[model samples]
Target: MLTLTDSAMSKSVSISNIRLYQFIREKCKIAVVEKNQATDDPSIFTQPKEKWVTMIVNNSFLLNLFIEDIDFKETCREEQEKLEKEKKRLDNNSVKKRPKCQQNYITSKTNHDNCHYHGAFVYDMNNHCKLTREQAQTMTQNVKLIASNSASGRSMELPKLIWDCCLGLYGIDPPCQVGSCGLPNEMKGQAIKPGQDLMTLVQNLFMNNQAAEKRTKDFS
Candidate 1:
């Protein structure tokens, strides 16, 4: 399961930050689903492959946003530096009037402590995806529901997709460009197929749903 470190949690109190974190978690779940699907069924490789690429691109974009917003890299650097300093201090401690065997044991303990801190840092870096395999399967079902609706021309707008799943929480619109507040026009009106790209698929589904709604009201 993905988890925010205490520092990350403390910094993510704002609505936007919380949403960003949630978005990352969801993408991780989706990636897991895509990976499993591709592995299980080679016939649909092209579709899942495209979706996986989209997931990676979008996730990377969002993660960069999160890192910048939360100053995550700086925080990690500071933490690592502190650990290094503590290790150095322990290493430089004077061994006063101790037996040679006792001194060896103390030195070994200090090394063990340093190794433990390093291992923890590595674990924190690696273990961010929070979903179990069962949970990922459930998430796959949800994605398929949306895809099936889209395929049947009964496209339903997902509330979360309205903001491209994350940016709306920051009071921004979809297709935002990096290092700028202005929204990009690259994806505007771009036609996409169901299961091609998750974000675009959802956005297209939303648009189709809106058009259908308007037509219904007009006919009525």
Candidate 2:
């Protein structure tokens, strides 16, 4: 998600950026496919053990994650006990609330004055007091409710190994000092016009190729 401003580096462009363009144009779907794969395991046989472990630890940590920790057993026991207590509490609450919820629903069904709307019993006109089976079905269809924790369906735009691919080596940072991806810290925020059109041009070229193939087939 590199965001460039409205012509920030119009004068000078980074060679690394140009290399990125070349990668997209030449490698076909490598960037896109690798990007998708990297979402779950970015390193994926590429990164060193230390780097991979560091990345994993940074993202998550269990109470007894490290065996080297002094109180590893104690930490594990404590976490287990806490988890049990939380589970018990949830179960007890569910058992206590079930009868109450059922009772309330039964009470509300007979009386149209108040009814549950979005988990709350409301008297507002916007919240219907009571609905026929058909009305309930119709309302449910019209309302566009999103999941509370919806998963992202979109894949990442670029591969995590953009630098590695360009340089034909692993673990090299972007803009390697040896002129790998293009340069080492070449005006960090340069406005790159040629690189900017990389995606658009690649897509256009692909579409044009497909069109030409279809035309050839029709004539044949």
Candidate 3:
């Protein structure tokens, strides 16, 4: 009977090393190193260095799956440190160069123009039209119905019409009270672009509504 030598049979392999090799073989591709004139030896009988020794990790997701939790956490900690350093550097650089409006939104002093004007107009209109709470709710439902129905084709002209109907005011030139209530012109020309037409304004209103709906859904 032939017997194996202790040098060959008694050698031990680490579990971590075995797992790493298995992971690389299962989740990554192995490639042979490209032959270069300086390193390539045609007369050498041995296999190329990269043929059995190199791993090419093309699938990042699979590679991540095989990584140890401890290693992954360490990498994330390092990355977060780097990001914090970068943010500190940027904040210092921007302290003197930041625009006036850059930090205004975070400040306590809000413009409040939209809130004040829009609220005032709505309150006055409720008083002028003698709209009860139930009536206001009904008008809200009607507006939502029109918005839902007008989501396709050339239905951009429906918001103003729905508003007009809800307020019981409709015509080529509506009543002065209806006009003063801020329907169709909420800002009273405060922020209107010089060349913007009615169609553009209506389109913008719908876009704002769509954005608001998306935010609501996201939060929900």
Best by lDDT: 3
Model 1 per-residue lDDT tens digits across residues 148-177: 867576655332211211212211242222
lDDT of 2 at 80: 80
Q: Which candidate order results from sorting by lDDT in descending order?
A: 3, 1, 2
**Model 2: CA > 4 A from native:** 1-71, 75-80, 89-97, 101-220
**Candidate 3 clashing pairs?**
none
Q: List the residue pairs that clash in candidate 1.
A: 1-129, 1-130, 2-129, 2-130
Off by over 4 Å in 3: 1-185, 210-220
Residue 88 lDDT in candidate 1: 81
TM-score per candidate, chains pooled: 0.14, 0.13, 0.15
Regions of candidate 1 where Cα sits further than 4 Å from its true position: 1-25, 31-63, 66-220
Of 2 and 3, the candidate ranking higher by lDDT: 3
Candidate 2, residues 1-220, lDDT tens digits: the string is 1223357556332234555544533443222211122447656655222111121232122212232332222334456899998887675445221111122222212343222211111111234232322344344444323222236544332211111112221123322222111111322365657645432333333234444344333433
**Model 2 pairs whose backbones collide:** 9-191
> Deviation in angstroms for 17 in model 3?
99
Cα lDDT for residue 107, candidate 2: 24
lDDT string for model 3 (3-108, tens) is 2235754843223445665665554343334343454676856443434433355545444544543232223445689999888767544422102111222212
